[model samples]
Target: MHGDRGLTVGGPPNAQSPPSAADVRAQLDILLASPAFDVPARARRFLSYVVEETLAGRGDRIKAYAVGMEVFGRDKNFDAQNDPAVRIEAGRIRRALTHYYLAAGLSDPIIIDIPKGAYVPHFAWRTEPVTDGPAATGPPPETPAASLPPMPRKRIMWLGAGLAALATVVLLVMVFLIPSRDAPVPTAQAPMPGGPTLVVMPFADLGGSPETKIYAQGLTEEVLSQLARFKELSVLGRETSRSIPPDADAARIRRDLGVRYVLEGSVRTAEHQLRVTGRLLDAETGAVLWSQAYDEDLRVRGFFAIQDDVAQKVATAIGQPYGIIARSDERRTQAGAPEDLEAYACTLRFYGYRAALGPASHAAIRTCLERAVDRYPSYATAWAMLSMLYLDEDRFGFNPRLGSPTATQRSIEAARLANRLDPENVRGLQALMGALFFTEQPVEALRVGERAVALNPNDTELLADFGARVGQAGDHRRGMALMEQALVRNPGHSGYYNGVLAQLAYLERDYERAQLLMRQVSLEKFPLYHFVSAIIYAQLGMKSEAAEARDRFLQARPAIFEQWDREMAKRNFRPEDATLLAEGARKAGFPVADTTAAETALRTAAPQR
Candidate 1:
């Protein structure tokens, strides 16, 4: 499997918490000092959004359970406020305001309370009646608004004093610029000091303009990159989770990613300001473990600083401080660099190609990938993507200059270069193995794929690829088992797992099964759906249908098959598969061009070659 697979879901008995009161106070102090309460340049920006949302008259309608999702654009099923870091920030926000009230306005005071079972912060005011003394000021006309209506003028005077005190606190608050007292804090328990597991979800774009999606996506990448520094945490890469739609179910995400926690947020860019809000959720129980919002003046230092801020906040909430987890060795090259920005943006479109694209479009994708590589030569993932695109081109017989050795050589080099850049990167390794296998270097392909699996013990893609190679190499039983395991990790995995299944089923003479697997995929949308279907149709007896499918495949493909001269259909693949496909095609009256060409494609497309 190329992505996280075999990840342990349940753990041993939990570690007991320390005594509650003292622990809460200590944690509260830390929380108060945390990013959510204090308005550092970046934190200030986040606070601005919170305040803006609060005042927009939209606050009253906001639901407590849904606040994070509504504010951050996370899936409704995943609550970000439950994250410990987020809760801690909320607590800190409350305490900061309380302190602000006590120290500043002695006469008039206002309190914002976060009621249980509610995600929205609630406001309350305390008042004292006025007296005849100089210390007693008449009510400010809004007398009935007081929560405590004890005495008339006497209570009003006390209320006036309290309001005065609160007024003074407001002055101090102005200087500090803290967040609202009602901000919710996410809950968190400290983890062991070493590596941790983390998932960074896509950031929501709240700039009132959908065009700002690029900025939000860029921020998500930025945050992911920032958090990758901790040698102790096995951070999930963007490629794995970035494709999850914003509205996807949390359970689906949890099952697919095999992660216990999820970090999601939003980004809003408007005028000279940028605001971001993030929350960490415990996927198992769908509780927000931590949450925070950061707003900054983009004009001053640029939004780059926010990345580091998010990293630090996440580290704090998780009880893994950035200073400790992110040692010098773990920091990735900053994403703020100009070249990285463009390349990352380009990479965002990769999934779109998989959804709807033709041969010419795939070529265009290759061109785009090449451009990305040109911008960030050391970007290992981009290189791997380019290699995958090349493989796709080859699979579709679109390789220009039919049967050109140069085409094979280009794929080999691209894969190799990608692996060299990021040795532990599974996709890169898979791409490299695929290139080698396609060129008939089975041994090397297996070795590289094995290494990729080792690097990511839980990666389903690596397992599927490994299985694919095995099946292609005549080890059907073992390969099929691996594919089954990969599917367990991600049932809804796109063509990656299914394509492998179809290939192996065909090779193993399970024509019916192959057809079933092909049908299970989102055929019209997935780029390789038709390709896999074409193989199954040709192998069975439906010659006319196979030919029609083949023609359709070719019409949208490059001209590489013009020289395909291999009799792959009669090879080590399941004999039953060959009989069924050929027989079915015969019955269906579909044309079956050169069966030899189809077989050769199957034989040569194996991961092990």
Candidate 2:
């Protein structure tokens, strides 16, 4: 049965009762607090607002744009028509509700659901079990219950024990089909929750030769192993996924295995050249997400060389930050909706904040990370990002606890926690390095930073950031190399990369190159950006442009300019680099510092090893 406007649904003819407003609200509270939800803050708010609005009979306000504004913190400028963020969020909320009921809310009295294609949420009472239904299995209506002969007591007990044993084995294969290297794969699915999942089906050998088949198998295994390294992705191991036939299409794999993403490819090996074609698919819809072909001349490259290069390129393309998977998630989760931040989504916010270094985004991401670590205390990436945010608080003036050592201490504590959780996490090591720099332990900081980059040279963001820090620490040439490599990997990288690269150019006496790179930095009220701009313009003898740039820097960073020595120490700049920057600023008509910031920076410089 249904209530007014289909807002209330009855479970069965004899449902106890449709839940009242209080019942729904109570359920909502439980759901929001449940560990099973594991939702970011924005998602929780979306659920609460829609349910509350529907319950209050104000369902008209549940439009996507309205919810986007009131609940998701979107402003009027939000383009609801173009951005499908709200629609994507609705689907995620529905999936979360299903996950919740399947686990934590199995016996709950009321049910809350956002039906397909609508924002109006419906409430229903749990249905009663049917007592008068047909028999579950066995004899038909022709046979009476009393007419059946009874089994012997000993045999019955034995049969019961056998059934229990069979049930246990079935449960393990069907529900916990975890893959291992030496073990056989079960022809069933597992239900390990959290994040998106992937299945790399065995690649086809188009050449159909024994050698080609062996090559394909090895390539497929390598790809699977590479994908497994991305901590956020839940990947089915090779032994388990190998049982899946190379031709097992995405739709069938999804239905049989419950994986969200599928990687399918083929290998064509010839004496002249080897060609590998790969395609990523949305398992649910069988929609292709990404596809590419790699062609390598066999005469020029060995099989192992080609395999390693293709594997590295493909993994980096699909799983790296702002890569295919990241972009796909961006659609499902509005990047602007900052609220815990799943450690997956938590580290992502750093890129957005790093882009502009605005106060609002900083505060929102900070709050999100705090809530995230509270919920998932063992999450290393969340702690790592929180540490960076703390560093930004002093670097960009986002901290309210100014002049206090609390933020710095918190930054160091969080970074250390991240390292304790995952010593190999490059981002965590980066955070630790930043914290070390904050404490004037530049020697340890540089060591940590060098180790971090060495640990994961493939991580583009780390390369860019470490480049900037090293440049500041008097290694402009080495820093320039790292930043350039990062820019190649991430073409759509943040403006900060260009900003740092520009400073390095200035240090190298390439004022023309510095000015060219400087023009690329957006005017977002970033004090350091304009400060460098002023120096570059003055060097080029553009007097009026230099004056304007100096004014912008002064207006945005009056405090930093006044306490120049402290800022220098905070930045961890090497003495030589600090001196060069100060000289440029002096030539740009900026006020001279009360004392030489270079001497202050000298105290923190790492000695030659």
Candidate 2 CA-lDDT value: 0.72
Best candidate (score: lDDT): 2
lDDT (10s digit) by residue, model 2, range 448-559: 9999877666677677888877877778899898898888777777467788889899988899999999888776745568988889888889989999999988887777
TM-score of 2: 0.65
Worst window of 10 by summed lDDT in candidate 1: 183-192
Error of 2 at 32 (Å): 19
RMSD of candidate 1 to the truth, in angstroms, is 25.1
- TM per candidate comes to 0.42, 0.65
lDDT of candidate 1 over 1-609, digit per residue (tens): 211122122211112211122222232233223222222222222233344455455666555344445443457577554654344334434443443344432333234444444434443333421222354466655656665433432234345545545744554344233221111111221111112346778888777555468768777776676556432345677866677788876666665555546788887877777777878776766866567777777667755566656545544444232122222113221233233234544444453454354566667667777775654344566677677677655554554545444555667666766665456666788788887777767778888887876665344546677888777766778888888876765454545667678867876668899888877776555544454577677666656655666656555543433433331321223434443445444344334454544455556676674
TM-score of model 1 vs. true structure: 0.42
Tell me how far the alpha carbon of residue 364 in candidate 2 is from the true structure, in angstroms, after superposition. Answer: 0.5
